[model samples]
Target: MFTIHAVDGYIETLYLAVYEDRVLLIDSGCRSDVPRIEEVMKRRLNRPMSQIALAVASHTHPDHAGGAPTLRKRHAIPVAAPKDINQWYAGFSGGLQHKIDIMLGHFVAWTLKYPFEMIYYKKHLLYDHPLKEGDRLPGFEDWQVIETPGHTSHDVVLYHAETQTLYAADVILKVGSGYRPPFPVSMKKEMRESIEKLRHLDVKHLLMAHGGPQQVTDFPAIVDAMLKEIDKGLPPGLKRFRKLERFSPVMKRYYRERRQAKKAS
Candidate 1:
């Protein structure tokens, strides 16, 4: 059996699944978090960087995929990512969206009163394995990857059926005692459908990128709460973040079509 270690990243909580001989990175954190991950492996775990067998990018977001290729280069770790991840930032518009996402990462840092740090990363990743729903993570077969595309079209979450624990990348966000959908619900309907898929899973522990891990009693209730928050949408005070989120091509087209449809009506 392996243990999970939490690495406090610049704007997210990164998880490392530690086995006796190898390690599995649940989600590759921001570019700025690479050294931090290496330090944790060396100092805390007392393990060589070579022990890191695989790094999984749940999505192509800066925080979720930025450090993956770096780890592969520095430690010879292979990255397992969504099959369509590279498409997120494929062209010129995608490149602009990538930069905007990075800026939003910094904006989140500023909102949390955290000090400045570099989080820039390349848009395209040299992924070794492309994952799909129900496929087990490469080199970490015990954990299963579930596609949960709402925050992003390529988002995924890992499920450990043995322990009923879920590594919910950015599917659900927590603040104090509350839970909410991620900032940019790029595909709202798909997000809801993805969350519904999760609701049917037998999950006892939930590990979140934004809020960290927590024990779940009634997983369905938690999911219901998250869905409610999504329905409520972002409040007026946080509307600026939504504006920034629209920079994504998917989000831009989503809103643009909505506006056009509203005007037609």
Candidate 2:
């Protein structure tokens, strides 16, 4: 009766809320995969392309917010996202970049800086409406928007109080991964804290962007495993030519590209 498909290589989630004659497509599969996204929408909705109701983005990341403009233009659907990051989408500010750097760890940031810029400039486009925490979207049965940071400053999770269904973007993923290490600004701490907050919430289904949805009955055990692994790691060892290799070549390339791009711009 309902459908959720992973879009492209983003590990992004696009939800289809089907109700009789109408449907709502959430998060338009990043800019690179618009065609595929549209096809998926058509196939799942089983209706004229024009009937798609609204497109909602969780935040400003290109992977999440990239396809909004295309979906809006082609389908004429209204688009909305967290209000705070809309400015970043417009390129007037560097808030999103700053936050990404903080959460992904500086070393990882150094590696991803360029790719992120390219992705941002190439994929990110604007939408007209503004979304904020607590705003209830049309069609959903009173889902409360909750502001969830640590993963991304503008991240927002949607909670259906009654169903206790939580659509946690990247902030909470069952994939059991850490914030791309060298440790992004001590995100280890933030992640732990965030998970703690979620533990107290009454969530029956934990739906993350990448992995499949998890049944709530396993919440405690799953949370414990994540926390355990999050704390486990080999002792610091190894050095590169008498000095530890703190960053990778990929990261160097990322930094170079971002810098060159910045200079050109």
- The estimated TM-scores of all candidates read 0.93, 0.65
User: How would you encode candidate 2's per-residue C-alpha lDDT over 1-265 as one tens digit per residue?
Assistant: 4444444433356665555666666665556556666676567545676666767788656556766777777778777677766433233234445344333333333453534322333324466666675688765545667776544445666776676777776665543443211122123555666556666678787766655466677555656665664576322531221122113232334458768999999
Candidate 2 TM-score, C-alpha based = 0.65
Off by over 4 Å in 1: 251-265
Best by lDDT: 1
Of candidate 2, the 10-residue stretch with the lowest lDDT total is: 237-246
How close is each model in CA RMSD to the real structure?
2.1, 9.7
Per residue, candidate 1 scores C-alpha lDDT tens digits across 1-265 of: 8998999988999998899999988899998899999899999999998998999999998899989878988888899999988877877788988998888888889989999988888998999999999999877788998999988888999999998999998998898899889878878889999999999889898999989989899999988998898889886777866655555566567679889999999
Positional deviation of residue 258's Cα in model 2 after best superposition, in angstroms? 26
lDDT of every predicted structure (CA atoms): 0.88, 0.56
Among all candidates shown, the one with the greatest TM-score: 1
- Model 2 / residue 4 / CA error / Å: 4.7
| Shift of residue 178 alpha carbon in model 1, Å | 0.5
* Pairs of residues clashing in candidate 2: 105-184, 111-251
